[model samples]
Target: MLLDHFDYEKLLVPLNLFYDLHTGGPRRPIFHDVAATRPELLELDRNFSAIREEVLNVLPERASIPRYHELDAMQTYISGTVDKDRDWKVFPLNLMGVKPKGFADRCPRTVAILDTIPGLFEAFFSILEGGKSIPAHEGPYRGYLRYHLGLVVPEENPPSIRLKDQVYTWKEGESILFDDSWDHEVYNSCTQDRVILIVDIRRPMPQPFDAVNRAAQAIMKPIYGGQIARKLATMTPPATDGDAPAMAEEKQTDDKEKASEELAKKLPDQADPVQEWGQREATGKAPATAGHSAHGDKKPDAPE
Candidate 1:
């Protein structure tokens, strides 16, 4: 029903502001009926049960996994803990626009499960430990819907997420689908750890919007892929001997920053029309016109 009224033929102007404006479309429920729209997701849910056990076997060495903030500087502010090993750990299946071959090889089952779903963009297993809280924030883009399947939820008094004004909890074997563009915060107050398989799926929009979204994604792929490539290059270990963990980590950070700087150079900074309009409105200033000045043109000293 929600997909019926969109203008499938209407193509959006390919601009950042257009996406920002469209992101305010009506919010869906904090959770969706996974069974109704995509029963296949349930199959993914089942596969993750085994994957969860596998993840636990290596939980002690989760440090080997790259931290989220290390991968993307934009996330530094809301990543909760500033430690090298974050309270919120992420085993990324996909980062930027590419999948890490090493990660995929390590978790073939998880990747296979992800492959079953069409339109899935980024996928990862997120492990949130007790007492950590992900600060309230909105996603940078609106073209995707964030999905979470509770793979290993706390048994009692589990953690909960607050999206906008509504609060929702995760139930193992069930999933929640919501627009991450909405302000949201998460708290894992429970004593037990919480793990979930997270993904961002291309938003299902009508005709022109979908086409426009596809075009936007295509344009972004190369930019994101470039950044990912640099990071991967540094992430791969040297053949002769691995750098000390600390040295390797420091190098990784340097590479990420360099890549980010390069990506920034490639991306044009979009002027914010909203901010410009607000400033004009606040100052009540109008454009100056010839022969109509605040000083009344001084009347040439009364033609003296």
Candidate 2:
């Protein structure tokens, strides 16, 4: 049921403004007719399943309790059970971190389609069967839209999600793109398991360049995290050594002070009784005696 006629020109203006105001936009039922792509999605599911296995093996042990009820009422089956574990969650589009090996190269079709727009393409696999739900949550920022392409939808009972006013039933091969910044939740009511491939893309914004910048940040943030990404965003490359004469002069001054300090250490010390007593007091050494001291001369060492 993939949509063939996506009138980019007609939607561009609203989309752009949506991006400007919300920092992202939502398109209702973008893949209303996406069931036609089921074959491709099935293949993707198989590929992702293998990847999921490998990812789970590589991940560290889970510590936190799984939040199952967040998705929907059916989540109880998958939630709270130690047996149920989510392994190898991969966020599509190098968003916020290093892009996993083979992810970009292997999923070329998905990447190509997503590249045409601005966003990420992610895949998730759940090991638990039946009644798993993702808790209600919003997207990180308002600059992008999210899409879910159902790859492995249980046959006995299907998973469904509510996005704002709409109720979405999982249809293998169908894609649903929506404004994830809005409240949303999903539930797998079926007796079987479910799998989905998700993507987060930059919605059309007033300034295309700004969108691009945000997208790059979104991609890098996963790898670098929020703090580092913000720092990187604000960072300006250092100017070449030749660019600032003032900086050069400051460095020279620092060097001269360092040299003078070194020379002073090598020279013989001048002594004063009062100063020597002050030095001893400062150093926490016994106060210099009124008598001749170790300095060999009668005068005391000078204060530092």
Model 1, runs deviating above 4 Å: 1-30, 80-86, 236-304
lDDT of 2 at 263: 52
lDDT of 2 by residue, 150-177 (tens): 5456666687877666677865544554
Which lDDT value does model 1 have at 166? 78
How well is each residue in 14-50 modelled by candidate 1, as lDDT tens digits?
3434554445456344444555544556666556456
- TM-scores of the candidates are 0.65, 0.43
**Candidate 1 root-mean-square deviation in Å:** 26.6
For model 2, the local distance difference test gives: 0.42
- Tell me the alpha-carbon RMSD of every candidate: 26.6, 26.5
